[model samples]
Each structure stands twice: as C-alpha cells, then as structure tokens.
Target: MSFHQEPAVYADLVSLNVKNLKNSIEFYTKVIGFKVVNETEQEANLSADGKTTILQLRKADHDRTNNRYTGLYHLALLLPSREDLALITMHLASNRVPLGSADHHVSEALYLEDIDGNGIEIYVDRDADKWIWNGSNVHMVTERLDAEDLLKDQPDPKDFTGLPADTIMGHVHLHVNNIEEAEKFYIDGLGFQVVSKFSDQALFMSTESYHHHVAANVWNGTSASSPKDGTVGLNYYRLVFPNKEILDQTVLRLNELSYETKDMGAYIEVIDPAGNHIHLVSQNAQN
Candidate 1:
C-alpha cells in the first residue's frame, strides 16, 4: 500500500508567510531546487515538479519575525530515494549552505532553515519492514549521519538539476502550547493514531502505520503563544483524505468534540489546539 495515496491521510502542501517574496523566490529556486509554478508581486507557488505546488510563499504584511512563537517547527520533504538525498546534500554543500543532519533510525534527514527562518527538512525513509517497533511506539533514534560514506560515489554536480518531481511533503512538525490538548485535537478529533512519543514533550501521529504524518512538540516553551497577526510563519498546511466520506466523518468527529470547522466547498478549514491552520480535503475534491 502506498503511504501517500488512498487509505492513508498524508500531508501534501504547506503555505508560509515569507518576509520578502523576491528573496524567498531566489532561495527556494537556487538553493532548494524548486520551480516557480506561478507568482504575483506578493506571493509565489513553488513546485518540485513543474505542475503541482508543494509549497507556497506569501509576502508578509508586517516585518515582524516570530522566533519563539507556536507555529511551524519544520516541514519535512520526503525524497524518493537515498541517492536523491545525497544529490541534494552535495548540491547544498557545494553552495556553502549550512546544514545539520541526523540518522533517525527510521530515516536519514538533512535540516536547514530558509531565508525567513522557517525550518525545512529533506529526508529519505528506510524500508517500513526494517523499522523497529516497540509495542505501539516506533523506536526512533537520532545519531550521527555518515555523510562521507553516503556520498562515496559522489553524484556529478552537473546532473543535479532540481528536486525530483516525486518529492513529497512528507510530514509537518509543529510547536504547540500543550501536548495533551494538541493530542486531543489531532488523535481524537482527526482520527489519527499515536505512533511515537518523546516522553511528554513530543508526539508523533499518523493515519496508517507509516511513522508520522503530523507531530507536535513544546520546544518553544509551554507558555509559547501563537504567532501574532501578520507575522512571518505558517499560513496553513493541507491534509488529504482518500474520499469525501472519510473527510465528512472527520468533520463530524471534530464537531462532536466542539472544535470549530469551516466548510469551504472544496476543502474544510480547521485550526488545531495550537494556532496552526489546517486544510482538510478529499483527494478527489482537490484541484
């Protein structure tokens, strides 16, 4: 079964408020290897493929930077293979981009912040059959990634064009005020299962057994408030369901839990316990 297709609810796209549209466009295109699908003076749509947008950048109304606010922690982009990860890593290294990497047992990831301080992660998952599970929780460990070993047969820099079309918005990790409240909204309200937990500090939830689709942590302090109006941060992220029936069922569950949901014809808008905006839509309903 494909983890990103039907029968599994997965994160598809993320929209963010960037400080400068032109600068952000340059960073995404040159550094991240994204093509500008469409753009205006104030906003731009970025795509790995030339067609589908995986990320969007909107010019911020205000110049404020919400460094410690409760919003995006990092948006993880899943590459199709380890070779893709190596290629991007080499490309970034050649460009003198600062990088942090880790081997998370389940996956190997490279982390960096965009021009606006919005965190981004590029990773490739190990085979699901090889993932270690301890009862209900998946055993994920952070260790040093041997970049040298991975790049032994270094890919030609000339062959590195851009991110492959198959790259996906794998998952999103967010900052929330309270883990329990966030859990209630994501697990009980959205019908996701807890796949992993880091004591009481973080939680990873997924629809199927494919590790995490969404995760939340209190790294910004429990008193961290949501980003103030017009601050540069997450605008929203999309969660795609298999069909309308499942999407309607999720809405019913949220309503039963007394969470406010707005039906926007093509999609449903809901905010989590943190002030993070989420758009829930069926695969067939999305444009």
Candidate 2:
C-alpha cells in the first residue's frame, strides 16, 4: 500500500498503562521534569512545556505482560534545550532514580523505565542542519555523558516547572527481529520514506525528511524473532492523517497493493511487518 507521500510527521505523544499512576507521575516530574497540565477523573496528562502532552496515564497494574500486546521500548521525549537536559539530570541524580544516559551523536538522551517496565527516554536534539548524511543515511554515534559538567551548570528544578505539552515526541526507538522485514512493512506498507539505513543493520525511516521517525534495529533478537510476548514492546504505530482526502487516498492505495484494511471514522488501518497495526487517522470535514 502507498500514501500520497504525505509530509513527514513527528510523533505527537504516546499513552501508556502505568501500574502506579501517582508513582509514575512523581517519577516523571521529579526525575524527568514533566509537569501536570490536566486530569480527567481517571487519567492525568503530563506536559513537557505547556503545548505538548507527553503522557496519558491509564491507571493499571505494573504489567510484565507488555510483550503480548507489545509494550513500550522507550518514548523519546525532546526537551527545549541543553539546560533543560541539565536540570533534568540533576533531578534524577538527586532523587536517585535508576537511569541510563547516552549521547547519540544526533542527540543527548537519558533512559528510564516506569513501574511497569515501559522504557522512557528524555532527550534533546542537535540542530537539524547539523545532521550529517550520506546518501540520505544519517551518521549517528554513541558517547559517554558528562553528568558532572551538566549538573554543574544545571538550572533550578523550578525553572522547568509547569506543563510540558510544548515538548514534542522527538522519535521512538524500537527493538524488532528483522530490519529488512520491518522496512518492507513500515516503509512499503505504511509509506514512510527511507531516511537512513545502517547498511543492513538498522533502518531509520520518516515521512518527509527529519532524521528518523522510527528506528527499528536488532537489539535482542538473537532468536530470530521478537523478544517474546509480554516483552516485545511497541506493538503498532497510530498515524493520524491530516484530512479525509488523504485517508481516502490511502485506502485506494492499500487496495492497489492488495492489502486488507479497515476503515475507521476519519481514519484507516493496515498491518505492518510484524503484523503490528498502523492506524491512519483523519478528521471529518464538518467535525
């Protein structure tokens, strides 16, 4: 199936079922620097700034069975600046939340898992223009983080106080069994253009051209299959199209490719490489 080759989309936000809502919220605010924006009797929305809502927590048990339905590998959250990164690092260290930090040449990031074992990555981007590319493939590297230096220049925690919806979902990293298969499913099926590829090792795909909206690699797939049910993490991508015209075009495209699809209100869905569902959403003209 193919799409109208729509403009690339960055992720908006992802929701997760947390075993402990209050604990998760506290960890995010104290360790990750997110702030509460709104609450619907059953859920709490945490924002990076005041514009983007990073999380919608569904109160549930600390589920270890994330693999069956596919749990989260890590939701990479983008911070406004290096200072924001610095402030967050300090918060994590002070609170002593178990965490991991890395500097992927493309960006700097910190990794953590919620109570349910869903990984979360808080990160910041290096300027887009600064990205190094060779034949549309991005050059990324890993380096050690200088925590002491960052905390030395860290701002007061209050500096990041308030809602953080302004924060965008930088990108999502996933662990899949096959790169080529994933490529066929995500790119060919979903129509995301191949932005960069690490030879046959990994694939970074996007819609327009940022770096990579989705990076699927061979992390722990030694068995030649996904990690396992309750540990697969990241089942599908819910893509929302801008309008019905686009949605209809997508349906026609899927028909051309001979793939089965279901039409949802203002949206449509198709299965990707691993049979993970990708939903293409649009809005009703009158609504």
lDDT of 1 by residue, 1-287 (tens): 56888999999999999888999999999999999999999899989998899899999876655467898999999999999999999999889899999999999999999988889999999999999998878888889998888898888766789999999899999999899999999999998899998989999999779889999999999998887656798989999999999999999999999999999887899999889999999986664
- Per-candidate clash tally: 0, 18
Tell me, what's the RMSD of every candidate?
1.1, 4.8
For 1-287, candidate 2 gives per-residue lDDT tens digits of: 11112344445556655656688777667666677777664567777664445566756533443243323457777776777788777666566778898877777888888666778888877887777877766777778877777678656765645424446677766666677777776666666778777767677877656666777666545244433322323434455555667667776777776778987654466765444445566632211
Could you say which candidate leads in TM-score?
A: 1
Error of 2 at 193 (Å): 2.3
lDDT, residue 10, model 2: 43
The number of residue pairs in model 1 that clash at the backbone is 0
**C-alpha lDDT values of all predictions:** 0.91, 0.63
